[model samples]
Each structure stands twice: as C-alpha cells, then as structure tokens.
Target: MATYDAALVLLVDSSEAVLLQHRDDQGLVSPNQWSLPGGHVELGETPEQAAHRELFRETGLTTSELRALWSGPWPYEAASRIR
Candidate 1:
C-alpha cells in the first residue's frame, strides 16, 4: 500500500466564478484537463501549507483565508499500486 498526500485550492471570485488550470497536454498526469490549483504535499509540510504554495505557484494568487472542504483517504487501485 502506498499513500500519496496532496492538497488543492478552490478559488472563487466575488462573482462566484471558480478558477481552474488547464493541465499541460504533454504532462505525465491528467494531460490537457481542467483542474484546481494544487499539487503533492511536501515532506514536513501540512496540507494547508501545500495548498498555499501550489495556489501561488500555479496562479500567482495569494490568500490568507482557507477553509478545508474535505480530508480523508481516497482509495484507488491500478495495476499493483494502491492509493
């Protein structure tokens, strides 16, 4: 069993429009797909920290306010890897 930790940010504007990023077509994962601004959580970092880092790294936007929508295991099985 392998566990991969990740964090994502749901950015909403005053107009209730949400922000999303288009993944690179040649990217290794989820190529050319729309996604929230986020990435894997680094060692020694909390999910909140990773969310802030990924949001700025991907969108150049920063915010001090964040609310967690969900947290738990997301299980998936492919080949012999479980996550």
Candidate 2:
C-alpha cells in the first residue's frame, strides 16, 4: 500500500492573464513542464488554507478572495507552471 496525500490547484484571474509555473525534471510525472500553483494539503487544514499557503510560497501573490477550483488524491510531482 502507498500513503496518499491531498493537494490543491491555485488559480488567479484579475481580469487579465493567468499564472503558471514550470516543474523541474524529476524523472517522475510531468518534468520541466507546466502546471498550476499547488501543493500537499496539510493535516487538519482545509483545501483553501493549503491553496493560500501554496499560492504565496510559489508565486509570491496574495489575494483577499481565495477559492478552490479542484482537488483529489493525485500524485503530482515537481514544480510545474503556475496558472
């Protein structure tokens, strides 16, 4: 059996362009590719909280309005495009 982890994909749209980050080569899933801002969901932490933390850490952007678009037990790897 494998330990599964939760994650959230952070997105921002200010009536302009969306954000995206590139994942470094890791010899796993997507490498040196593109993905949205996201990361592992913390214990006892809501998906929104996780997204809030990731968005700043990954993109250095903050917003008063935080929303979750999607989430699941997907084994996402490495840093990818943040949109």
Candidate 3:
C-alpha cells in the first residue's frame, strides 16, 4: 500500500467555535465546502511545520505556538479522493 503525509490546524475562538474556510468555488475538490486550514506536507518538513506553513498561506495567519494532538495515516478511500 502507498502512503502520504498531511497537516492541518484547528483554530478556535473564545466561543469554542472552530475556524473554517469556505473553499474557493474554483477549487478542484469539495469546492465551497467549509473546512480547516491545511495541506500536504512537503519534503524535509514535519507535519507541524507544514501545518504552520499551510495555515499562513491559506489564511494569512501565523503562529509560533503549536501542540500536536495526534498523528496517523489517512484512510485510503479519503486519500484517494484527493488529487
């Protein structure tokens, strides 16, 4: 089986509501759907590093603080669904 790595961030407000983005309608997958900020990990980078990079790139937000909650392989079906 093949495998890959990805990173994501869950930003929450004082109200405990999660921060979400409405994907551009022009996005290739799940367009217009609301989701957190994230993307695939790049070579020589850790998931947390990728999460920070993606968060800034996608949302123009940056942070030096991060706490990993978990790590694991993505389901084959879901991974395959993405490009």
Candidate 4:
C-alpha cells in the first residue's frame, strides 16, 4: 500500500499567522519550517481531516473551509514571521 500522511492549513487571519514549528540547530533534525497548517495522517482519517484536527489541536481554532492543496517542503527559516 502507499504510504499515508496528514497535514493542516491553520486558517489564520489578522491576529494569527501561519505558525512555524522548528527546533534550533541543537541537533541533526533541528532546523525546519513551512507556511501552512500541517501534521500526520491517522487511522480512519484523511490527510485533510488530520490537518484540520492538527490545526485546532495545535493552534486552537476552527476553519470555515478546508481544502487539500499541494505537496512540497516546509518553507521557513530561523528568523521568520507569519503575522
């Protein structure tokens, strides 16, 4: 079977911005980010579903609408801002 996964979009607005979660260069996998809500896939749940869940779970908000977009890498740096 194909590998499954999940992600989010964090329907942010004026107050909030596309949140970027990354660790410092404290280790090997300690530096990365992206501009959108995201997460991992779960059982009995689509990637979009997982993303929505993650959006609320991580940021604490709801999206009036959610859509499955593209696939790529997280585009963020150490000194970046969303809002």
lDDT of each: 0.77, 0.66, 0.78, 0.56
State model 2's lDDT. 0.66
| Residue 44 in candidate 1, Cα distance off native in Å | 0.7
Clashes of 2: 11
Reference-based TM-score of each model: 0.81, 0.67, 0.77, 0.51
Compared with the true structure, what per-residue lDDT tens digits does model 2 show for residues 1-83? Answer: 23334454556477767788897897243568898876767778888887878888878987778766666665443323221
Stretches of candidate 1 off by over 4 Å are 73-83
Ranking by TM-score: 1, 3, 2, 4
Which stretches of candidate 3 lie above 4 Å from their native place?
1-3, 75-83
Give the worst 10-residue stretch by lDDT in candidate 3.
74-83
Q: Which stretches of candidate 2 lie over 4 Å from their true place?
A: 1-5, 26-29, 75-83
For candidate 2, the per-residue lDDT at 1 reads: 23
Winner of 1 and 4 under lDDT: 1
TM-score of 2: 0.67
Worst 10 residues of 1 by lDDT: 74-83
What is the lDDT for 12 in model 2?
A: 49
How would you encode candidate 1's per-residue C-alpha lDDT over 27-64 as one tens digit per residue? 54467999998876777988898899989999999999
